[model samples]
Target chain A: MIEGRRAALPPVARLGDAALRLVGEAGAMFLFFLEAFGRIFRSWGQFHKTVRQIYFIGVKSISVITLISLFTGMVIGLQMYYALAKFGADGFLGAAVSLSLVRELGPVLTAIMITGRAGSSMTAEIGVMRISEQVDALRVMDINPLGFLVSPKLAASIICFPILTAFFDLVGMLGGYLTGVLLLGGNSGVYWYRVSAYLKMSDISGGFIKSLVFGVVVCTICCYMGYFTHMRRDSVGPEAVSQATTSAVVTSCVLILLSDYILTSLLF
Target chain B: MQANTPPDIILEGLTIGYGEHAVVSGIDAVLPGGKISVILGGSGCGKSTLVKHILKLHPVLAGRIVVGGHDIDTLDRRGMHCLRQRMGVLFQDGALLGSLTLGDNVALPLREHTRLPEKDIRERVLSKLGLVGLADFYDYYPNELSGGMRKRAGLARGMVMDPQLLFCDEPTSGLDPVTAAELDQLLLELKKSFEMTMVVVSHDLDSMRAIADHVLVLGAGRVLFQGGLAELEATQDEYLRRFLDRKAQERSTPRLTMPPLDQKMMKRDCGKYLDE
Candidate 1:
């Protein structure tokens, strides 16, 4: 009985030590952004390579970006036509599709998809690095973890979001055009003219600004989730990665949608 | 960037962690120039954390880390980067970037720190890779290499900068005994050739015995033992004794995790063939 108790004691002691290490891991989480920024600027060659990585993480993510944005435009076009036609203002289809896709759906949906595809990969990549001690290795070499790991992703999001939004704008309008004029027989010329004319400066500008903010939000949340994944590495399972993917997408969606409303009201 | 200091690396009550709590604390160490010291411990004993504080990877929690006569905690980003150009590190499991080729990985620090022409960088890469016995494998991707080769490739990358201070974390974990021995010999050769002050963190007893001029044994955030191999062999501490004994067991043990009888029989008759 005494030997049994002695054997149990060491394991309990190990648990306590593990718990303390978990706390240390959590403490490292908040330093993610600062660390990445420091690493990027510290090495000029790393900075150049970072630019290349950002291109891959962002520009390479464009095909999915295009697909999701186009579908969203189609969905919203159908939804708006129901209410607009109920009020007997069918001609506003052009105005509706353009305004909706440019100011709201284009940026928001594009951001959501990017978060799901690229953001999760970022989190998993960083999370694996965190668990595997790649981050710790960087520190020992006097290389900052954030500069090499997190900064390139953040910078990539910044560059990609706007161009992706532009793509979202073009494709979503095409989706809207297909759904509105081609499907519904709402004159194409009238639809194009109204969209172009009705879209105020802020509408396009608001969409652009939202893309930038969404970029930060997506990268921040993804990096944050991955950066602090030490707690759930073993128990977190594939479900955790999926959940992280979901949370990132959902958070960026909520932020983009809510902020679109706020920015629209403020800018207009 | 390094000033004239007797010891190239110094830590005084160096405390570091996330916030409030200290992961590695009360560390007072001085690494002299031109010798190899191994920070010996098992996983999560704060050995890695201790090395981070010395490198000033994060803000010091409550102590001082003076490297080459300059206080590391006081240095800003650019200042730290400048100081870092003087140090090289070989990370465990070879954290060579998967996106880069072996030659490119070796050339990374040089390309980042200097404006040397492409030819000069390539020449330097070849030299470093050659030193690590990877002369013919420069263009290979990290995925193509074996585990031991990857570690050597990482060592080549670390050496490309010709750093005065070199740090290697867990240099021999998960390697075959012969490979680990070869690596230990290479590290000794590198130190003598370059006059480098090398700090190696490992739980490998064979490696510590083979390469260390001094050993700083750590357990939980305090120094358990600090001395040369001869002194370590003569110590009466039970914790150190059990620790070193386990390492010797690991070395002689077979790759399969079953009992020794199975390993012996398998080696003698090649089990499947014997059964047939």
Candidate 2:
């Protein structure tokens, strides 16, 4: 006996479904943010939890962030010196390194690092809670999972990311100074002079704002993915959480890059 | 929990599911106040879905659920939150927060909702833990506890607020029979001592027989039976009988018996192996 084969949907229909799903996800994220932030200013209950999150997401991440920033700064100093030497402008190494660190590398690299460290772990933590039915337990207890779980992390990221980025900038500049002056035989006086002359308030502020935005984006996306790990009925088993964490990390990285470009264009 | 009060929860033509597909539809039942009600069903028959609906986790797809005289579907977010405050739930896995100690886990609800002083909170936490026989295990983390201990701790946390109603999802699913019986006794004791309504979702016949004042049987997305343990025993429904028989089979220990290996069978099969 012959079996009947089924017809597939046209590409247009598939595209429409994808579009609708995207809209639904965006709407969910917005609603989740509204719920989490609504409780942000209303309670003292969250203060301790937020502090705990800051320690986890900010303080614990400091060493790694510092290490990466220092190396990045050194690489920039070395490459910039060689490039400027070609133009007989090697003296501008200080200004170049300082500008790159402040305007782009500080915020971008710090966010990327945190995304891998804090963001991924946040997703895993919440995802485990989801699988373990702890989130549901919170709901059953009349506690808003968002208020209890997501809000603290969100507040922590918002408060700590900018601070961490600033630290990254500071450490990075010191690294560049070490490479450009002590190692490369550049004049320390000229280096400091050029850095001061080239750096502006706008550049500093732009980077700070970018760091703030990236923090919000990373926390929101990662938490959103973890919180909604089991939204669908088919989402079951241990694998569901693993999938959510992967999706969260990939989505956060893509969003960071995309928004970075947009923020850069608007700010500069 | 008030004696002689109307049923704490009333469902009329309630349909529950994710999105458009109805896993359980047209569910109508009234679970009496201050009594233990057990929801029973085979796998995928939507017992958990119905429990979620009763908890107001998702929107009711198609009908009315009146809890404490208010139609749940009509409640706004604030109203829903307020309604939930009076309810406590014990998840299948206990759902204790791993980061917090057992003491802190029980104290979470109080910390979040009340302005009680640290001394008072600590006292209350100890009291709750003592109730669950975990008074000395306060500083232990969730992972540090055994499965039974974890469930007891989860129960302690659930009862922290002394909620008017309690909902337990498969409270004894993974436990050994002895442990399951212990949990059943605990449930019975809680029911008597706390004077709160209980709604338990379980497929365990022994648990239902032990603790259920009212039993609700669900199948094919509908309420197949709603009655007491005696009435369940008297039920003539073929599906329920089949389910009971299947559960009985599952509960029985396996015993293997080998066919006699001497004489005729050995002559026919063993000769080949022996290379005669």
Q: For residues A61-84, could you state the per-residue lDDT of candidate 1 as single tens digits?
A: 778877877787777677766667
Q: What's the residue-level lDDT of B96 in candidate 1? A: 80
Model 2: per-residue lDDT, tens digit, B1-276?
232342478999888998878898888898978899999998889998888888877888999888888888887888777767678888777899998999988998888788899999999999989987899999999999888889888888888888778888898888899989988999899889888889999999889889999989999889999988888888777888888666453446556567656655453566566766
- Please give the CA lDDT of all the candidate structures: 0.77, 0.86
Question: Which parts of model 1 are misplaced by more than 4 Å?
Answer: A1-54, A76-88, A140-145, A228-246, B1-30, B41-44, B58-65, B74-79, B236-276
Which residue pairs collide in model 1, if any? Answer: A35-A146, A36-A146, A36-A147, A39-A147
Which is the leading candidate under TM-score?
2
Residue-wise C-alpha lDDT for candidate 1, range B192-240, written one tens digit per residue: 7888888999988889999999888888767788878899989888888
Q: Which residue ranges in model 2 land beyond 4 Å of their true spot?
A: A1-7, A232-235, B1-7, B245-276
Q: How accurate is candidate 2 locally (lDDT)?
A: 0.86
Q: What is the TM-score of candidate 2? A: 0.90
